[model samples]
Target: MSLGDERESSGGYGGTGQTRTRLPDTDPDSYGTQRRGPRSSSRGLVTVVGVVVLLIAAIAFANRGDGDPADDPTTNKPEAAATAPTGKQPVDAKAAGIPTGYAHDRQGAQSAATNYGIALGSADMYDLEKRHAIVNTVYAPDVATAQLPDFDQAYSGESFLEKLGLDKNGAAPSGQTFVSRVIPVGTKVTSYSDSDATVALWYTSLFGLSGESSRNPVTESWYTTTYRLKWVGGDWKVVDFTQKEGPVPVGRDQRASTAEDMTKAVEEYGGFTYAR
Candidate 1:
């Protein structure tokens, strides 16, 4: 879903569909930071794959401080995770099949925030009733009640869905494919404590419709979703979260794909449960 122009002007769903209008050039806000430009140059997806590598390095530097790896202007040194295996493994099973029960450590907190980013940024957030289940599943039980009403407005807000070419229920019309997905690229620990931690999950999101005749055709947008996480009942849960624009690279102009082809690609490519 490439909503570059439209989203920039209208302020598309920034981090779970709040009433977002625009992003500052590069300062922190209530949600996210600045706005992301379109990925029109060359093959955007391929470029996205490459950007993830740099983001991994950026996360390492942020955690370890503006240290050795990034200090030298010429040294193309690798970050800790890129240099060697961290020995951590993905959780095999899920709580309600959602990859829960994270370790009570720094790495574990990072892992939990990454996975929850995927869950919250998912298409499930669009489905009115289904959205509730996702909130209850990943968000702490205490704040979830207060959060639901705001979510209801964002996801089911009357003309908002219409603008994206979705039906009242957030579905694409028959024969059209609606895509709302988040692909996590990196993670960083902003702050951490035994019971509380702040982490940011960097990722790309796909939103809009995939159909030959669609108006709001599928678009790609970059985002960094920051989460205020809490260790609860032996797992990390989102106490609060925010979304901001990007550090997107300049895109190289390229031929656009056909609607049918875009739809096919989206269908064939499955989403993965991201881990740190």
Candidate 2:
């Protein structure tokens, strides 16, 4: 889904005038083991594109919330009470999993959006198997069934996977780790209703092709991606989403971290259950 085709610039990190690697040659057996129908794969590709766009929206929203002239009103408020309620918490999580299982209330919708935002931007999504699981888990049930096959096709494409420095099923080389991680900074409910809600998910993403022969090495970018969700099938499922440039702060000249440090930080830093 994230083609990494072109380099664009704005906010904290400037584009380095480089694009990620290209996909590799196709093997006929690549899709032989796939369990999806052609129509299903088409729907899955749409879901992947939608998720990618939503991720960009979350980054822009986070960077915007970080202190921008245009975002003064939203920023001026005292930050939401950091502590969540003690009982019947609207939030929910599976043991040791990314906090995605949310309730159906306004807070629940916001929480779902935020959590799904993390899952969408995670490094795991780059892998073929993991990407399939993520799409099935994060999207509404019906949407997942209709979309998973296509997502599988898109990511499994020889050229596309090659671009990300991955093999079929999106796996990186033995000694190399493919990095596509999202770090959620916070979340805010821009608007809400009983059945529909718009939530702003703020976070940063780590995306690039990383390996010895990699064209695009690991690099980090800040952004905020927002989603419009609908309470469907007893959970909050994304109905639609959009993205914009950013509320990114001026660039800082902090010394860049080493590739190893960046990789370690990604592995060590876990995402959060964001709330307004």
Candidate 3:
């Protein structure tokens, strides 16, 4: 059965109220020590060091009186807002080419959900081996094992592949590039614990084929996916998730990129390792 058929038959894992859509045809050096010199040279160096120290001390005192710019309401510096960077670093490891090794906190759960959502929506999901690897890496062990066969059946349908202008193997036709990308606009932690957390990722996705001969030109969709994550083996892994179509915004009046340009853009640009 195809993904749509599976969704219709059983609602699928984490299907919730999500509407299933048809597939479009589619990352610093040190210095060495020096030898001591003459007394005058040593004294000069000491004087210079002392002067520098004093200058630093003076600057510190001046800044101390002013307090932190962030703390000072009168300061012109922008306040830390919800949209501001959280200073949290992204995961530094990869499992089956998907980012892993997330921190063990709410932010980590959110990050894991966001990245996993991207992986789930990626073009790689269309390929059996790649999809399996992604599922094993992103989902909890039991979930991965249980869902593997379902995923394979859902994504491997010959009709589904053909609808997207792909072969049974999910490869695009020659000279055509399939596009499937999810860009997380934001994430929120709705629930949290040491062992479990629930995160919602709001995102926009581009999917379809970017080629001159394609009938389903690349198009964008907005979605929000809620992921229930578990801390497993020192990393956040998906336990369950649900997707819902947009909280979509009004479409903007802009010229769409040509197929060649879209293909080039997808090829030239790289996806991000998202963080909170």
In terms of lDDT, the best-performing candidate is: 3
How does each model score on TM-score? Answer: 0.70, 0.62, 0.74
* lDDT ranking of the models: 3, 1, 2
Better of 1 and 3 by lDDT: 3
Which tens-of-lDDT digit does each residue in 30-100 have in candidate 1? 11112244444554454323444444434333344566765764457554465565636787768544688
Q: What's model 1's overall lDDT?
A: 0.67
- lDDT tens digits, residue span 149-212, model 3: 8788777778767766789999999998988898889998999999999998898888777777
What is the C-alpha lDDT profile of model 2 across 88-169, one tens digit per residue? 3545555225565567676687678877777766667666667767776666666667656645554556775676667776
Number of backbone collisions per candidate: 14, 24, 3
Clashes of 1: 14
RMSD over all Cα atoms, model 2: 18.5
> What are the runs in model 2 whose C-alpha is more than 4 Å off?
1-3, 6-90, 209-214
List the lowest-lDDT window of 10 residues for candidate 3.
27-36
Comparing 1 and 2 by lDDT, which wins?
1
